[model samples]
Target chain A: MLLGKVKGKIISTRKHEKLVGYKLLIVEPYYGHKKDTFIAADKLGAGIGELVLVARDYAVKSGLDKDAPIDALVVGIVDREPEKK
Target chain B: MLLGKVKGKIISTRKHEKLVGYKLLIVEPYYGHKKDTFIAADKLGAGIGELVLVARDYAVKSGLDKDAPIDALVVGIVDREPEKK
Candidate 1:
């Protein structure tokens, strides 16, 4: 898992049928220097600027239709920042 | 999902009880320059030096015990490299 801040919402009118009701959030990882960002499926109602735990991979597809093409998922909102080196 | 090269194996005799029998492999991402590496749970029987698709987050927990603490998983062995810019 990685720590990321939700930067914005993605409005997709046309997406996989299984992904119809899920909210897609653009997240920027806290640990990487690259400007690359990815969209994560959110079920926890996380908002922009909220820090969240993003589960990547098949884990993102958990609890949803098995055919969903989701690649990242917001599992939780961090209540506190973890101590870092 | 991200593409990674399996570099080594992780032998963990003591782990979450739900993770006792899983194989863990060290993986390096193909698109990053950082020397950082991570362990991924493998169910596809990927071998060292092979390229594999890593699913991150809750997606990694698919098909396993729901309580397993796995964060990365090997979902597929790469049959072809994706075209890069």
Candidate 2:
């Protein structure tokens, strides 16, 4: 899992078929890492700027559709901010 | 799929049983991205410093064991360097 913040969300009306009812969230890892922003499937209602844990592998689609093109998923919402190094 | 270059190899004798016969390579994406080095299973015999296309999602384990703990796989080797903008 990767620690990241939900930067924003993408509202798509015509995405892949398998991703119909899911919210696509844009997330980026916190400080001390590259600012690579990626889109993940949000199920736990992660909101903008909220700290979240993203699973960016097969585990994301394990319970859903094994072949879903969705590569990332928000697994948790962290309650506290990360301590600055 | 993401484009990356093989930086080095991990020689481990006591890794997960599912990753026994595979070569674990350290790969980093090319310029214009965060230098996040990650390990991926190499089945194509990619060499160090070679540009490769890594599948960092479920597609990687589609053909093999879907439950395999391997998260990334070198899907293809690029023939030339990426064009800089």
Candidate 3:
């Protein structure tokens, strides 16, 4: 799993059938030093600027379901602030 | 590659050396239906709520160079809005 922050949303008009109705959000992964940002899907009610945990690839597909066809998935939303100590 | 939005940050007191300076972001992939959010590393200067593209697994390692032990990495940030029509 990885850590990131919700940046924004993405709207797609043309896409695959497997990916309909899903909310797209831009995310920045929080490593120790700096923040790395990217795009991902939100299954939970995660809003922009919320700290969230994510799973990817096989982990993502498996987390959602075997037949979910998802490459990424938001597993959890961070409730408390991350400790830098 | 996949799509996601920046959600939040992750701070770990102890981590791998390769991941020391790398930024980790919470991301949700845009899978057409519902967003499948995940955590990924960002190499670009993407802010919160920015639509970005991600490369996972081998793609990530290769994109950032083999020496890097990154499982996920942001390759591109979406400049325009994704069409939902």
- Predicted structure 3: lDDT: 0.65
Q: Per-residue CA lDDT of candidate 3, range B52-80, in tens?
A: 66667743533553366776677666667
Question: What TM value does model 1 have?
Answer: 0.53
Cα lDDT, all candidates: 0.68, 0.68, 0.65
Q: Model 1, A13-62: lDDT tens per residue?
A: 97778888889999987545337678888777888887776656645444
Error of 2 at B25 (Å): 25
* Alpha-carbon deviation at B25 in model 3, angstroms: 26
lDDT of 2 by residue, B1-85 (tens): 4556788998998777878778899888653254577888877788998876565656565534435788777655665653432
Model 1 segments more than 4 A misplaced:
A63-66, B1-70, B73-85
Model 1 DockQ (Cα-based): 0.11
Top candidate when judged by lDDT against the true structure:
1
lDDT of 3 at A68: 33
CAPRI docking class of candidate 2: incorrect
When superposed on Cα atoms, how far off is each prediction in RMSD?
9.0, 8.4, 13.2
Candidate 1 lDDT over residue span B1-85, tens digit each: 8898887664533233455576766677877643435567787899988989987765655646564546787888999777767
Say which candidate scores most in TM-score: 1
Residue lDDT tens for model 2, A1-85: 8888876665544333455577766566776343365556777999887999887776776645445545677788999987977
